[model samples]
Target: MSGKGVLVYGEALVDIVPATEGRRAEAVLGGSGYNTALTLARCGAKVAYNASLSRDTMGKRFRVRMAEEGIDQRFVSDCDAQTPSATVESIDHDGAASYRFRLSGTAFDVAPPEPADLSDFAHLHVTSFGATLGVSGQAALALMRRAREVGLSVSYDLNIRLPVLPPPDQARSAIEERVPFCDLVKLSYDDAVAVDTGSGQDYERWFAGGLPLVLSTSGDHGADLYLASGGMISAFVPASEVVDTIGAGDSFMGAFLASLWQNGGLGPLLRDLPEEISASAMDFACRVAAETCGERGCKPPRLKPKPPYD
Candidate 1:
């Protein structure tokens, strides 16, 4: 899949969210990879989504949404299996969510488009189901390996689902395999804890060795950025009118990548991007997430003009 902008590799699932307490759930087009692509395109980045899309109704809706946003769908492959979906149940007054997956293993299969198929892409963003589940996990690993060989800047999100993935010990082993392939990693505090108790020096030590950067989000507490060459940077959640937090993190990632892509640099940016440049990316990301939270569901707004740094 050749592209001018970022290519997001992962699952494109429908999010069946609760419309009213104890009432029927409304199915919405979502998934970290799809949401990231949608947000990036709306932000005016030339983006493409590479995934195995089901030919079912939900998959059709998802593809239509991508086209409507002007995101290229040439890399998407069609399948006959049922589209995977997440049945979401919100918890507490904050509207934070708990999810249960209905999986069909009907996500991306990496047989076609050989590595040479990828051309002229500025970046690759990977996350969610395709990064960890059965065939999806292998697909992600293959693409990451190819990206490495072809010299494409890469980012990953450990959007871990505890109930759906393997046991903790096994999950860590799986996660460890992909971390080294990424220049940037975005994982939530919950993911950090669920994946490896995320409080130990082990994670920092690993980052120090392989990963160039990581953004660890702590829900309402904002996020912390760890840089390989520099110390940690922090950004607090800017105050905003609260809405359900669905897709907030994905929006953060979308704006984050958008900042780096459009930043005026001809040479590779992720590996040696200046300290301030990365910090500015976080600030923009945090604002994007906050704005997404202000709206219901995962509707990421168009990227506003870049704001002055704090």
Candidate 2:
């Protein structure tokens, strides 16, 4: 886990955010999956991004950003379609963003990679629109199955949005079908309420069925970590100067995964980590998320370890 890498699979798109005090849309490298890769690379995790990239200007910007952030582009899939772009509007002064996607013509057509392509990684994480929408949906599910088959620690995030996906029941069913293979499942409370999350019962059933961990986050209320072995860790949140929480959840996911892998690979952490270590990891994730929220977009403070969580 320390030396191999974390392979992040899913959408890499541009988030066009309107300038808070202006009328123009400012483009940020968008998508939850992309942000997680970026943060992990910035944290010094050996990271590779796996998604289709277009040859368009926005795609070029995304490619450059990945390079600058130290993410490996070797697994990228090329597509003739335009790069995906999501339009996000700030609904409140807190910089909380509401997103609507423009994906039909974009390049999220990811296919599962050849086994050799993924052999170098120690862990894998997938999220966002790639887990839904038919275009890349089957590919995503296929990749997760293969990852689990290969015995990699697999993580999934249900960052689902109703506006871009199928009906709730259909979406929920797809996700549930993959739950057995995942070692960790992360969600925001809002994500839980969305299609495919199945409220808390889904999490309970997965846990009862032997899923390793279920983490549910609530902005500003801290987060909850439920273990399959029977216990819970309440991850306390640190305060920060409020800016806009554009990619807070992604930042949290990246940091949490990084921390978990650092102390022990997912298998070890799930079965053996002390409560203090688990709480410390969550606190570190919260700090990274808080710092991201202190800025306009998904910027995690240069990733560094803070004092351990008490």
Candidate 3:
């Protein structure tokens, strides 16, 4: 509980994806937090996953996956209800994917947090989807507030899914409500454009008061890092072969957090980072993301030890 590591709080669900060359389907243990936690654990980070699951087969499988990946499962809560599941449609030639969630009264919706049990984590990463779950939003916000009160650094991934919310405006409002609570924010190029100005240049002004460090990912074109001190860094690393783009963004986030953990200068780096150093971090994270895209799922390739400074 007193570890110098990150705790990922969100849902742990199963992804029912179509198999190659046929109509057969495969159920994979996947979720935003689950993918990020697994990626971080694979990259040799001490990670803990805080999610709610059901006392069902899928939940057991999810727990087993976490154990195999060497992630700490002490925070996984089990309830009597069933776990959420997503049915992912077949992938297209561009490696894009679509999904239909079969979520209703899942365990995450009813799970409550125990503040005393989570005060020891050094950092907390919350997904946008996790914050919008029924009643889970209140629980997650309460936990975030408690973590912030105790001086834990917070990161938020604006992994927006339009279908989950009532409307596009409502979704944007909900995500905007949580921005100020996060020290680090991650968003894709499309997400940034949609949430703010249609141009990526306006992202800094959009969340100027809330996020100190913002990461914007442009598929295939690489990623950009913006610091609070008027510094901008960008990196471009093209993919070798994109098997699927389902969890590429999550992989980038996992690597970004790992870099900050190893460097131990996240606070200063966020506020004022040299362009070259920030670019290097983005380059390393880009490699992590590209490697993940080479695989079929969210599993990221092992990362080599990077130099301390660029």
Identify the candidate with maximal TM-score: 2
- Candidate that would win on lDDT: 2
Off by over 4 Å in 3: 1-3, 22-24, 115-119, 193-207, 267-277
- Which pairs of residues collide in model 1? none
Which residues of candidate 1, in runs, are more than 4 Å off? 1-3, 21-24, 105-115, 264-267, 305-310
Q: Give the TM-score of candidate 2.
A: 0.92
lDDT of 2 by residue, 1-310 (tens): 4566888877877887776555555778868888899888776678888788888888888888888888988878676788877787555765567878888866875453534656777788888768656757777788888887776778888887778877888877778877887888888878877764645667679988768788888888889888877788887666567767788899999998777666654543454557776787888888888888887678787775443442
For residues 41-139, could you state the per-residue lDDT of candidate 1 as single tens digits? 877677888787788888798878888899988888777877878888664577578888877545444322323466768677889757776877787
The segments of candidate 2 whose C-alpha lies over 4 angstroms from its true place after superposition are: 22-24, 110-117, 196-198, 267-273, 306-310
Listed per model in order, the count of residue pairs whose N, CA or C atoms clash below 3 Å is 0, 1, 0
Native-structure RMSD, model 3: 2.7
Model with the higher TM-score, candidate 1 or 3: 1
On the 0 to 100 scale, the lDDT of residue 210 in model 3 is: 55
Alpha-carbon shift of residue 191 in model 2 (angstroms): 0.9
Ranking by TM-score: 2, 1, 3
Question: Per-residue lDDT for 66 in model 2?
Answer: 89
Q: Relative to the unseen true structure, what is the C-alpha lDDT of residue 108 in candidate 2, on a scale of 0 to 100?
A: 70
**Model 3 lDDT per residue over 119-176, tens place:** 5467888875876556876677777787777777788887766667566677667776
